[model samples]
Target: MKILLATDGSSHAQAAESLLTSLPVPSDSELCLVAVVEAPTWQSDVASEHAALREELAGYRREVEERLEREVERLKSRFGRVSGVVLSGNVVEQICQLATDRQADLIVAGARGGSKIRRWLLGGTSDRLARHAPCDVLVVRPRDDSAEPARGLKRVLVAIDGSASSRGAVERLASLPLGEECEVIVFQVLAVVRSFRMDIVEQSGDLWEAERRQAHDDLNWAADRLRPVTPHVRTVLHEAEYVADEILTVAEEHRADLIVVGHQGRSRVSQFLLGSVSSAVLRHAESSVWVVRTEDADVS
Candidate 1:
């Protein structure tokens, strides 16, 4: 597997690096380290080309390059096939572009660190990276950031929604050759619209049964895909008003290290207008999250 890791040398990024050493990815997989140097925003198009501001950014870029060189040496000690690149521009955009250029199978990053304006793995940056990255993006919180120590990589929670999106998440995960010790939970929630109308509620009992049956089928399909990684696959079907909340609950109950989710492939504004489940999980899950998009599913 080709994995691209974006780090800023912050404590949060360090946690992500530490976690990477324990991940289930093959030891021989190619690992690329990327550090982005973000320049200050310009008030006008001409302002960006101003010589003074250009010189300042160039100096900062040199500092970042030095730091990246040190980090490369440190990480090389951990990763077998490792490389580093220093890019100048938007953090999220540069990372996304490099992932596309390198055809990375996954993009790993840490959350909430560095300057507020330049934090690469939270707020708008994390949201955009999850939605726009060419492949899966894994967001990890620093261990200290969590109230409880995260469980090991043995267990993972994958939320299935019976859509191409959910299937893609599972497919990407199954592609990874996780160790035999790994355990996977294919979890689904019965999401039925609530209707106060007695007639509508009574009429939907049969449909609810059909939904449960379909959930089982989807869970089985996910199980088949995951069995290659590990035989310890289990399925859970639940009904709740907030699917995201229940997903976290299950992950916590099972002590899952990672929560795998698929991008609904909806833009933020579109989701605000449409629906939410995957997005909510990405935002709220205290555990590490891996978001795979349908576009990344078939990337061999």
Candidate 2:
């Protein structure tokens, strides 16, 4: 498999790199390490700072290139066949172009990069890459001090709500270039765990235990459906008040290095609302996340 891993030197970015070490890519498979540098623009008010800013920007680019070189060297030692490519341009645009030009099978990146709030408000670089890239994408989170990294995906946790998008996530997981020894933990979370119907509002059920059992059964059924793809898979059911919290908990308990989930488009009304659990997991999980969305009109 040919894979492109993008980094920006953030801890979250390196977390993505760490996850790749556990993937079962063949020793002969190719890996590309790319770090993009967006040309710095000077403000009119700070015109006098142009030369200084340019120098500083050039220095930063050199630093990133050196970092990429070292990382590629380390990766080649592990994967046996890997190369590095560094470029200066718009981060998201450059990554997409590189992935398409190289016919990369997968593009890996950090879930949240240098600016989380900025990305959230103005659309994240990772989010844009995922939407526009030609191949599958793996958006990994930084290692959280509160959580320990999984040795490997001992048990994979998948979130399915019976959507084709979610199903796509399952299919992608089945096709991952993983080692034969790896196992899977398939599961799902009910976003609205409880809903009150008092007055006109729907409320969450008080029978939380029963809801949990039902959720478990749903996940079990999904796992059974995936048995053909992976015989070593297990099923889990979780019922929590919030989706993201439940996912992180399950990940910590199962020690999952990779979390596979399908992307459900956000409604316009909800776009400004709290981000989805998958996004939250991307932000918080001490693991790699693969978000499967419907194949777009643009096919590489």
Task: Report the lDDT tens digits of candidate 1 across residue range 40-112.
Answer: 6776668556777778777777777788788788877666788889887788899999999999988888865
Q: Report the Cα lDDT for candidate 1.
A: 0.76
Which parts of model 1 have CA positions greater than 4 angstroms off?
42-56, 77-80, 115-117, 146-152, 265-275, 296-300
* Residue-level lDDT tens digits of model 2 in 1-300: 788998777766777777777765666678898887776445656766877777877887788788888888888777757888878767888888998799887888877666211232114777667656677788876446322245555557786654556667777776654444667787776554233546322333445455556666656666666676556777765545676778788888877767787655321123211246556766567667776655631221
**Alpha-carbon TM-score of each model against the true structure:** 0.84, 0.71
Q: What is the TM-score (0 to 1) of candidate 2?
A: 0.71
Clashing pairs in 2: 156-185, 194-203, 194-204, 195-202, 195-203, 195-204, 196-202, 196-203, 196-204, 197-203
